[model samples]
Target: MSNLLWLVPVLPFAGFLILALAGKHVSRVWVAIIGAGSVSLSAIIVLMIGIGFLLHPPATGNYSQTLWTWMQVAGFNPKITLFLDALSLVFVFVITFIGALIHIYSVSFMTGDKDYSRFFACMNLFVFSMLLLVLADNLLLLYLGWEGVGLCSYLLIGFWYESEVNGYAARKAFIITRIGDTAMAIGLFVIFYQFGTLAIPDILAKAPVLWQQGASIATITALLLLAGGVGKSAQLPLQTWLPDAMAGPSPVSALIHAATMVTAGVYLIARMHVIFQLSPIAQMIIAVIGAATLFIAGFSALTQYDIKRVLAYSTISQIGYMFLALGVGAWTAAIFHFMIHAFFKALLFLAAGAVIEALHHEHNMFKMGGLKNKLPVIFWTFLIGSASLAALPLISAGFYSKDQILWYAWASEGGNPWLWFIALLGAFITAVYTTRMMIVVFWGEAKTEIGHHPGKLMTVPLIILAFFSLFAGFIELPHNFGHFRLFSDLLHHVLPETVLKAGMDAELQFQLLALLSTFGGIYLAYVFYYKQPQRIEKLRQSGFVMNLYLFWFSGWGFDKLYNVLFVRPVVFIANINKNDVVDKLYQGVTFVTIRLYRSLSFTQSGSLRWYVMGLVIGAIIILSIQIML
Candidate 1:
């Protein structure tokens, strides 16, 4: 099984290469099968191995396979190795499972498109890169996969290269994430310099020794890595690109925003839990950033009319909650939330795709009322997804994961009650926006004509994800109810358990807090959107509130700020250098040289007498100088 682990990423990459190189000549059906089939096969293998590993666990609790020596230098060798442990197994299952579903959905969603082959090629490549990211045993190999996924994101986001906005959106996602990638690369270098290796397990093993020697070194390294995570996860200041990422096809949006790329940051921090354990300050920063991002993105999501953009902002916010969990030392809880979040979020986005397809690409909720009967499959799937996202009690997978995170936030070592308060507020906001979106899009009278119903291919994935969204939470039920802590225990081998455990009484307090937050959010959404939709209209009419809403709607004006601070200034400087500096200096030098040569050329005159005199004069001068020497 370990030996075969390499095939999980290899098969998809091979499919991508074959389809990409020969797709133009191949039939579209073959291309679809090759593209989707490659990932599906990998998913099947992963399921088999994953189940076997889970049932008959390894004694050492890890399985490693080194494919080959990727690079070797003096005392530095980074092998292309695949590792399957509790952590990597979870991510691999999600990447392959949700990834395969997205691939299947793309087949019907993208049928008859001219560049269908190219789209599938990029999708397969994305799965390959994402799999490598999770499976790699060393930081160098992980970075290779990291950059590979980013490249695929840029490719797939702008899959329809003919649209200038699509190309622009792709560039935005690439450049913004690159900022974090650069920071992360530097952090990796810092780790190597301090620890003298790039192997992840080795680094984690040695982190405690380094921390005990000099705690500041560990803090700097951890913070730098967090910076990288922030960028990749679309947290806080680096979150503007995600909303605009909707320019891609719906399946691409579902994959990038929901399943794979955006979650890389959370995975990174969780992967380096050892380093993070040493830096309390860094952890606090992570928590605070996560809280801030949740509030900002939640509020921003409330204002979005574009269906995909709303879901995009919601992703940022939900991932922020996961970061908050990680920051608060609830590593198991964070990953638990990540697993459940993947199912519901992907379902929501895919369901949104179905809605758009039915409404002839209409995305605004205002234009999408009363779709319940018109698209029954989409409505039921979306309801299950929305219920999970809203964290409805007992029924929602999000209820289990999110409740645990909030509980940990209030009870963990160094936990602050205020952070929990803010998180609760964010949760309410999440419910409100999600409810408003659903009501406006599916509950009211039909505002647009429904063109066509979605095919079984699309709805099947939605139905499967919906089931998970509803019931996946039972894997981590609270202690008061018999304490089925399967998820936390399964993940303990990989994640660090905090020394300070919350008291039993504190558990009840945490539950009350979570219930209030969840119900408050639902109530606000019902009151504002369902009971009194006119209030939203009135709020929209207010000048101040309208401007505030607009600002949030535009991603807190980060795009404008980037344009002014970076883009315009760089363009202006380039223009000035091109016209005033380089042209003037270079052309001026050329003009002087030309004029000097012309003036000097008059001495030649092209005459035999002049040539003879010039030669004699030159020889006399040379002889005079030689005589003086």
Candidate 2:
């Protein structure tokens, strides 16, 4: 089973190769099978190996398989190896399993599309890249997988090449994420230079001996890695691209947001927990960024009218919770939320896809009304996902995962009151936007007629995901409740246990406050959007409120701010240098070469005497040069 680990990523890569080679010639049915079946097979392998890992833990508490050496230079040898442990196993399971489901859903969702095979090819490649990312035993290999997903994102997001807007969105995602990728690359170089290795186990083992707590070197490397994570995960300042990324197909969004690309950063932080632990400054920065991002993205979600755009912002906000947990040393809690988030966020995106398809490609929630009755499957599944996103008390899985973060944000040794308050406020805003989305899209009068209903192909994945969104929390419950520790206990081998700064006496009080925020946000959304719509309209009419609404809707004007700060200046310089010194230098070389060619052409006049004379002149010149030398 351990040796077979290579098959996990290979299956998807093989699928991608097949589809890319013969896709145009194959029928759509075969395309679907080749695409979805490959990932499905990978999922089965992961599940079997996962069970083996649990039933019979390895002697080292991890399984590593080295296929071959990747490169060897200057005594730096990194192998093409896969490392499987409790942590990477968790991510691999999600990437393969949830990824398989998304591919299956894409089968039906992409029917009749001209580029059906192309879409599946990019998807399989995307999954392969992500699997490699989580499975890599070394940072260099990990970075390869990281860039693979970035390239695949640009390909899939702008899949419908006919759409200019989609192209812009794809470029935006690629270029912005590249900023973080650059930082991560530099971080990796520093790690290798300092530790003389990029292997995960080696780095973790060596970090403490090499750098003291809060050392400048440790802090610098950690901050650089965090910048990379922030960009890839769509955190503040680098977050503006995600909302526009909704321009891609919904299944693509699910893959990127839920199970793969966006979560790569969270996995990075968790995977290299020792580095962050050694740098308290970097850790605190993570918490502040996470808290601020969640709050900001929640407001953006609130202002979105596009259904997918709302979920896009919701993803940014949810990942913020994961970051918050990581910053507070709640490693298990962060990964736990990541798992639960995968379930519900994928459900939401797929369900939203169904709605969009049924409504003749309408994206605006205002145009979508009374869908609960029209599309019961999507409505029910979407409602479950929404409830989970809102963390609706004890019923939804989100309550367990999110509440854990809330507790740790206040109770952990690294946590502070201010972090807790910001997180709590973000939770409330999350609920408000979620409720607003549900009402505007699923309730109210029917504004658009349904064109079609989702088949079992599409609905089954939603049903499966919705079940997880509802029940996955049972594996890890609160102490005052069942105190189930199955999830956290499994992660104990790889991640350190979170230490509490306070006793459990205030747990219930904190839980109650979080519940109040959730319920209050829901009730407020009901009042403003559902019950008295006039109130929302009137509030929007107010000058200040309207200004705020526009600001949030514009994603806090980050795009405009960036344009002024970066894009405009660069464009201006580019325009001024349209034909600058470098161009003239090249043009002069071209002019001289053309003149020489013309001068040389006079001797080639189809005359044998002229040709012989030219050869004689060339020989004379060569003989004179040799004699002089």
Candidate 3:
């Protein structure tokens, strides 16, 4: 069973190659089977492997398979190896499992499209890349997976290539993520330089002994790695691209924004936590970045009109909580939240897809009202996802996972009142926007007629994910409940222990505070959006309120700021030198050649006498030049 770990990533790659080669020739039904079947098969094998590992733990507590010696030099060698441990196991299962579900959903969601085969091909390839990322044994292999997913994103996000905006969105996602990828690549170089190895275990083992806590090298490495995570996960500064990434198919949104790529950063940080733990300054900055991004993204979610864009910002905000958990040394909590988040967020995106299809592709929540009956399945599934996202008390998975982070934010050894206050405020904002989106989309009067209802293929994935969203948290309830931390216990072998342990008194206090903030935000949302809708509308039109509204709607002008700061300057320079300065030498040669050709053309006046005279003159000039030489 352990030997089969190599097959997990290979299956998806095989599917990708098959689809890429045969998609245009294959029937659409066959395309769906080859696409969805490939991933589904991988899921089954991963389940078998996971069950086997759990039942018969390996002596080393991990399994590694070296497929080949990838490269070797005098002192440098990197191999094509796949590693399976508690950490990679969690990510692999989520990716293959949730990813398989999303691929299934996409088949029906994309029905009647001309590019169905292309869409599924891109999706299978995306899963293949992510599997490589988690299973990679070395930093070099990890980087390959990192860039592979980025390439797949560019391909899938622009799948509808006829649309110029979709192309723009795809490029934006690729370029922004590349900034972090570049940083991560440099961090890998730093690791090899300092530790003389690219293997994760080797680097982690050497980091603590080679560099003291808060050493400059440690800080630099930690920050560089964080840059990669921040960009991939859609954290602050690199986050603008995600909202626009809604330009892709809804299933693409679910896969990238939910189960896979966005979470890569959190996984990267978690995987390399030892280096981060060596630098308190780097760790503190992680907490601060998470705090700021959660607030910024939460407020942005409030102003979104597009249904997918709202979820996009929400995705960013949710990942911020994971970063906060990582920063606070709640390693188990961060990963636990990531799992539960995958369940709910994927559910939310898929359900949103069903609603959009039902309404003939309408996107504005303002325009979509009272879908409770029209889209009963979608509404209910989305409600489950929403409640989890809002961190509603007890019943949903979001409550347990989010509550863990909230408690750790205030109770961990790294805790400060300020970080807690900001996180709590962000939670409140999360609730407000989530409730607002639900009310606007599902609770009001019906604003439009329903079109095609979702087929079972679409609703089936939603039902499965909804089940996870509703109950997955029970596996990891907060510690105050007396050891319902099955989720954390399972991950304990891989993660480090946290210094923060709450006494009964402190746990009870934080729990109460979190509950108030949770319900308080919900209560306020009802008062503002549901109960007194006109008052909220009036506030939106108010002078200063409108300014803030526009700001949030424009993503706080980050795109515009970047345009002025980066994009425009580059564009301006290019325009001034529209014909590149480097090309001028060629251009000058081209000018002389054109002049000589024109002069020679005039001499060839369709007469043998002119041709003969020109040849004689050219011969005379060649002889004169040779004599001079």
Candidate 4:
């Protein structure tokens, strides 16, 4: 099983290579099969291995396979290795499983796309990179996967090359993420400098020893790691790129935003939980940032007109909840939430994509109404997804995971009452916006013609994901209700058990709180959007609120803020250096030399006699100087 782990990533990479190298000549059906089949095969491999691990658990609760010695120096060596433990197993399952479904859905979603081959190629490459990221044994290998995924993201986001706006969005996503990648690289260097190793396990082993020296260094390193996570996860100041990322095809959005790329940050933090455990300050910082970002993104999702943008903001906000879970020392719960979120979020995005495709690329929610009847499969699947995302009590997967996070936030040792309060508020807002989006898009009167119905290929994945979204949470119900701890118990072997533990009564409080927030938000959404749908117009009528709404709709003006703060300044500096510095200095030097040569041309006089006289004089002077020397 260990040796076979490489095959999981290898199959997708091979598919990418084949499609890229010979796609133009290949039939579209073969291309679709190759693209989706590779991932499906990998998912099967992952499932078999996961089942193997579950049945015959490793004594150490970890497994590793070393392919080769990646690098070696006197005292340092990093191997090309893959680690399959509980945490990485979860990631592998999500990447290949959700990734495969998205690939399948893309077949129909992108049927007539000019760059269908190119799109699948990029998707395959992304799956390979994401798998490599999770399965990597060392930080360097992980970074390689990291950059690989980033490259694929840029390519896929700009897959429709004819669209200038898509190109711009791709560039923006790449550049913004590179900023955090740079910081993450620096943090990796810091890790190597202090520990003399780049292997994750080795660094983790040494993290405590380094932390024993001082809290300051631990906090700094942790913060730097958090910066990288923030950029990748689309958290807070670095989140602007995610909303704009909707320029890509819907499956790409589902793949990147919901299932794979953006989740890289959460995976990174979770993978490095050993180092994070040493820094309470860093953990607190994570909690605060997560709480703040959840609300920020939740509010932003409320005002989005574009259907994908609403989902995009919802992804960011949901990730914020995951980070909040990690911040409050609920590692297993965070991973649990991430898995459940992937299923439903991908389902919603893909369903929205089908609607967009059916409406001839109409993405505005106002243009869509009464789609429930026109696209029944999409309507039902999307409802399940939205209900899960809105965390509608015991039936929704999100409810279980989110409740655990909130429980830990309030009950954990370092958990703050204030942070928990903000998180609950965000949850309420999430339910409201999600319900608002669903009602406005699917329930109202049909405002536009449905150009076509989504084919079976697209709807099948939606049904599967919707099923998971509705029931995946049962794997991690709180211990209070029959003391079920299957998920936590499985994770304990891989993750260091945090000291903070929720009692039965505390768990019950969390369930009640989650239920209230979920129901309250849903009711509020109903009253506002269903009962008094006209009230939405009234809210839009107020200039101040409308402006605020517009700001949120535009991702809280973060795109403009980033341009002003980073992009514009960089462009300004480049222009100044190009025009004022390099051009003037280089051209001035060349001009002066040319002028000096021209001035000396007078000595030639363009006459044979004068040239001979000058030569003779110059020779005499040179001879005299040589003689003196």
Candidate 5:
């Protein structure tokens, strides 16, 4: 069963190839099966292997399968290998299983589209790439998967290529992430140069022995990797692409932006935890970046009227929490939150998709109202997701995971007072924006009629995801509550043990603080958006608040900043070089050659004698040059 791990990623790629080649010729019904069925089969295989892992675990708690020799040279060998352990298993199950669910939802979401086959093709390929990323045994293979997801993102985000705006958004995502990918590629080269191996386990084992704590080399490598993660996960500065990515289909938003692809960065740092642990500086930077991103994105989420854009900012903020956990040495807490985030965020996006489709692509939350009665399924399911996202007390999975990260941010060895405050504030912002989104989109007066209801295919996935969003955290309950840390304990072999600097009493205190923050934010949102809607209108009319709103609404102007600092300069240089100065020398030579030929044209004035004389002169000139040499 373990040896068949290769099938997990292979199934999705096979699905992609089939759909990509013949999907257009076939009916939409078959396209749906080929797209969704492929991922469903992959999920089944992963479940079987996951069961095997539980029943008969490997000696090292990891199993590696080398499919074939991929490439080999002197002192270099990288294989087409797949690894299965608690860590990769978690990621694979999430990618295939949750991914399968999203794919299923997309079938109904994209039923009538002309580009349905193309959309599914990109979607299937994305799952394949993500599976490869998690299952990879070596850095090279992982990078292939990493870049593969990036390409798939561009294709899917711009799936409706007829739209010029979508094309720009897709290009923006590609170019921004490519910056970090370049850095990661360099890091890969450095790792190969320093350690003489690209295998993940080998690198982990060798890095500590070869490099000291706080080593510059290790710090550099860690930072480079963090850059890649930051870009992929939609962290600070690099996050501008995600909201714009909402230009794509809602299923694309749900699958790539919410669930699988956005979490790729978290997986990278966790997979290479040794490097981060060795460089305290690198870890500190990770925490700080996470802290800053959450705040920026949190505030940004507050001002968004676009339903999908609000969730996009919320996704960025949530990933910041994951980053903060990684920085504070709560590695398992980070991944635990990542898993939970996937469930709820995907649910929210899908629900939002249904709402948008029902409204004929209306995205503004302010323009949408009183959907609770009209679209009861979407309203209820979206509420569950939003409640989980807001960390609404002990009932939601988010409270369990987020509370751990906040407590750890304050209580871990690497934690500081400031980190905790920032996270707490971000949590407040998360709750506020989530409540605001739900109130505006679901509650209040009706702004439009619902033309259609989401079919069973869409609603079923939401119900399944909503169940997970509410209860998945039970798998990793805090020690203060009881001994239900099954999620972390399962991955104990892969992750280092986490300790709270402040013990159980402090744990309860942080939990209280988290609870308070969640309620405070929710209360504020309810008061502002729900109970007294006119107050929101009045506040919007104020010059100061409106200015503040506009600032945050523009994603803190990062896009404009990048455009001025990077994009505009590049475009300017490209324009200036459109007719390159370097070409002048060649142009001058052509001009002179033309003139010389014209001057010599008189020599062709009609005669065998003139031709013979010209031939004789050419031969003499060649003879003279040879004699001189």
Candidate 6:
């Protein structure tokens, strides 16, 4: 089973190569087969490997397959190896499994696209890169995969190159993520310098021996890595890129948001858990960033009129929850939420795609009312996804996973009441925005005629994801409710169990508080957006309230702040330096060269006499120089 580990990532790479080279000559059916089939095959292999590992656990609690040496220089030998453990296993499963579903959904969603093959090619590459990122045995290989996804994102986001807006979004995603990537690269450099190797296991084993818990190097490295994760995951300061990323096709949005790019940061922080543990300061920063980000993004989600952008903001907020869990040392809980998030977020995006398609590409929720019966499959699935997103009590998988995070936020040894409060507040805002989205999109008066119903290719994926949205949490129930720990148990070998503060046993109270926040937010949204729409209008009439709404709608002015701080200065510099000193030097060289050329041209004069005279003069000058020497 370990020997077959190489096939997991290879399959998708092969699919990408085929789609890139021969897809244009193939039919759509074959394109779909090659595109979705590759990831599906990887999913099957992952399932078999997972079962085998469960039945016959490795002594070292991990399986490493070395395909070849990636590089060897100065005692730095990193192999092209695949590392599979409970952690990578979970991520690989999500990437390949949910990735396959999104690809299938894309086959139908992108039906009339002129660049259908190109879309699949990029999608296949995206999956392959993400798989590599999770499975790589060394940081260098992981970085390769990291930048691979970034590049693929740019390609897919700008797939509709005809739209300048889409192009801008793609560039924004690429450039913004690069900031964190740079920090991560520097962190890798520090790690290699300290440990003399890039192998993850070697680094993890050596970090503790080389540096104490509060060592400066350890803290710096951890914070650097966190910066990288922040940028890739679209956490604060870098989060503005994600909402605009919705300019891509729906499945692209689903794959990037739910299964691939945004989750990369979570995986990075989890994979480097040892470093974070060594730096309490860095860990606290992670917590604070997560708490602030979730609150800010949740508020922003409430103001979005575009359905995808709302979900986009929700993704940011949800990832913030994952960060919060990680910050509070709830490692398993963070991953648990990640798995559940993938299930439902993907469902919501796919269902939204169906609704958008049914309404002829309408994106504004206000313009898309009364879709309930017209698109019954989509309405139900979207409702299920929204319920999970809102963390509606026992029925939704989100409730269990989110409940665990909330519990650990205050109960863990590192946890505090303030982090818990912010996270809880975030939960309320999440439910409010989710409820608002549901009501505004599906429960109002009919505003647009249905364009067409979605085909089975699109709807089936939504149904499958919707199923997980409701039941995946059962694998990790709360202590007060069945105390199921299957998910955490599987991860115990890879990640440490979170420690609870001494004498803290208020899990039940925390759960109830989370439940109330969910229900309260839902009821409030229902009343304001559904039952009494006029209330929103009256609130809008208030000057300060409208200003606040506008602020949140503009992503809390992060973009504007960035424009003033970063964009304006850069543009100003470029405008001022249109013909800078360096250009003047080159221009001067050109001017001198042109003058010399004209002077030499006068000697030619397009005549035999002029040519003879020039040759004689050149010979005389050369002879005189030789004489002088």
Clashing pairs in 3: none
Poorest stretch of ten by lDDT in candidate 1 = 496-505
Off by over 4 Å in 3: 579-581, 611-629
Cα lDDT of candidate 4 equals: 0.89
CA displacement after TM-score superposition, residue 154 of candidate 5 (Å): 0.5
Scored by lDDT, model 2 comes in at: 0.94
Candidate 6 lDDT by residue in tens digits, 142-218: 99999999999999989998999999999999999999999999999999889888899988999999999889999
498-541 in candidate 3: lDDT tens per residue? 86756778977887887888888888889988898889878978
Model 6 residue runs over 4 Å out of place are 502-505, 603-629
Considering every candidate listed, which one attains the maximal lDDT?
2
Q: Which digits, one per residue and each the tens of the lDDT, describe model 5 over residues 510-571? A: 89988999999999999988888889889889999999999999988888898899989999
State the number of backbone clashes in model 6. 0
Cα lDDT for residue 188, candidate 3: 88
Q: What's the CA error at residue 300 for candidate 1, in Å?
A: 0.4
Model 4, runs deviating above 4 Å? 73-75, 499-502, 588-629
For 331-398, candidate 4 gives per-residue lDDT tens digits of 88889999999999999999999999999899999889888777889999999999899988888888
State the lDDT at 409 in candidate 2.
Answer: 96
lDDT of 1: 0.89
Candidate 1 Cα outliers beyond 4 Å, as residue runs: 499-501, 580-629
Task: State residue 459's C-alpha deviation in candidate 6, in Å.
Answer: 0.5
| Residue 564, model 5, lDDT | 92
Candidate 3 residue-wise lDDT at 461: 93
lDDT of 2 by residue, 448-495 (tens): 999988899999999999999999999999877865799878998788
Backbone atom clashes (below 3 Å) for every candidate: 0, 0, 0, 0, 0, 0
Show the colliding residue pairs in model 5: none
Greater lDDT among 5 and 6 belongs to 6
